[model samples]
Target chain A: MPGETFKEYVDSFSYGSRTDLFFKWLKGAAEADAEDYIQSLLQELGEVSDTGDLSKFFEMTYEAQLAANSPPGEDPRWKYEDAPFTPLSKPLSEMRVGLITSSGHYVEGEPHAPPELSDYTQEEGTKHIGEYGRAKPFLSAVPIDLPQEKLGVHQPGYDIRAAQKDRNTVMPIDRMKEMADQGVIGEFASMAYSFIGLTSQMRLTREDAPQWAERVKDEGWEAAVLVPV
Target chain B: MSVGHISRAFETAGTPTVIIQSNVYRGRVVVMKPARVVYTKHLMGRPMSAPFDTERQTHVLREALKMLETATEPETSVILPDAYRIAPK
Candidate 1:
């Protein structure tokens, strides 16, 4: 920590404190250099330039930058050629159900997804995946069926304190079980799938999603509930 | 938006799907058109509501599940009646 610059110390301060300091510094710093300073500062704060709106980048937290850059007034970055057309074949109480999520829930002691497959950049995983697109083969599924004590949250952005205390907040393995027990759904798929949901690697998704669909079908699940974190 | 894409993928392949999501992804979900989007006002990670709040969580899930039978249109969205109260940090 020795000889760190004043700005480095400022970066170490909490976001609110840093924002206050940033305004103070902005008032004294050269107006012409403001944009450059912001861009560099954001880069220093672990934001990858390829993601989000560079124009208003300084205003976003590391967590929200990805959405900020979603092509002006259009939908999210990627769009499919086909419209959604699938319809349920049965009632909720008669269909088999399963859960899938992008929250990065994993068994407590198991190996995390290799960075090549599911990037884990601590913040802005979508950004990392975008930059790392198809650099390696992407594996589609991370199974979840452990006890609450054996579950962990690997997704970043947003507070996971509640989830850390109880995995059901996101994964809801126990809740799914309850739904099956109560006849809300006829049955829970014996296994559920979890993935690092923040990725932008469409290539990987295009490759893996149909496979996941097949897996769900193979498991006898008539429906899948997608929980987005 | 990967969630939206995955939903589309599953539905495209003939498996019905429902998305339990926050309003944060509403625009994209609307555009991409998942089978059903059960929108909730919960915090990003707590889509089923706060941890260990079993009754509320179960209620949210039931509502989302029910959409499978009721959502007849593409990109159908059913908003949850309750919200995830953000506890003071």
Candidate 2:
């Protein structure tokens, strides 16, 4: 095994063998040095060169490497749900519209909730991924007409320079108004909605999203647009 | 992931929603079948393209709004004409 990289050893095995070995490594690493485990795991990603092989490896290890507590045998595939449909009741120029985004937006001087970070711990022969804090939802919506100076964004990772320069890139509330003035949509709803996109907890989202939806429906908006970061 | 759920929430609440996303999400959106999707070949964060380029941003917005009007079936999508080319700093 001298001078052989992780990927080299991984590639020597058949598909089932590789998967079994990957889980063994993942679980053992979690029980040993979690930080070094993640670091070494990421290093192997750079050694694989083929897109198809890389993608397969990623799919195989997604939860084991990331959310180590994900229940085994559960498929993480994005399940398609037949969402309820509503046709445009009128022409675009005559519909009242609202905006929603997962770009971590909130009004200035207002409190915003942060996403729950994973708390990983190793028990005897197992990893215990605790249900940490709840993902903070900006439960209140904002007026679409709010001035750019009065708004704030807390999303990290992606470069925010462009968005800070022009909030239209993420929130687009001002652009929504301009569209209203131009009759592309009849009017902008009095308010728009935002949520931080970093969380993995679906329970909190399931609770918060419907609250906002009730408000949007109450506001009588005929259509809305979801802009994701 | 959250986008599709929220879109479904809006649609279920009787307000049809059009999702504006980057081309990176084409497969996911096609699978989830939001009421309508308008994708831009722009980068991830700047869905409407560059800042202050109101013309291009507006073009993207108009295209998204147009799909809301003209898409005849569920899972329909339109790709805006803009392509993202990252410039060296």
| Predictions in order: lDDT | 0.64, 0.63
TM-scores of the models, in the given order?
0.70, 0.68
Question: What is candidate 1's lDDT per residue for A152-174, written digit by digit as tens?
Answer: 66654345566678767777788
Candidate 1 residue A128 Cα shift, in angstroms, is: 5.9
Model 1 over residues B15-60: C-alpha lDDT tens digits?
A: 8888888764565667775778887766445677666777777777
What is the TM-score of chain A, computed separately for every candidate? 0.59, 0.56
Clashing pairs in 2: none
Per-residue CA lDDT of model 2 for A1-229, tens digit only, reads 6896655444333122333322433432233344554565576666665332343344334323333433233334555656456788889898888888876677887744442321211111021112222344544467876887887665442345566677777678777888999888998888788776644447544776677778888888888888886
- What are the TM values for chain B, all candidates? 0.86, 0.85
Candidate number achieving the greatest DockQ relative to the actual structure? 1
Show the lowest summed lDDT stretch of 10 residues, model 2 chain A: A120-129
> Candidate 2, overall lDDT?
0.63
Native contacts recovered, each model: 0.64, 0.50
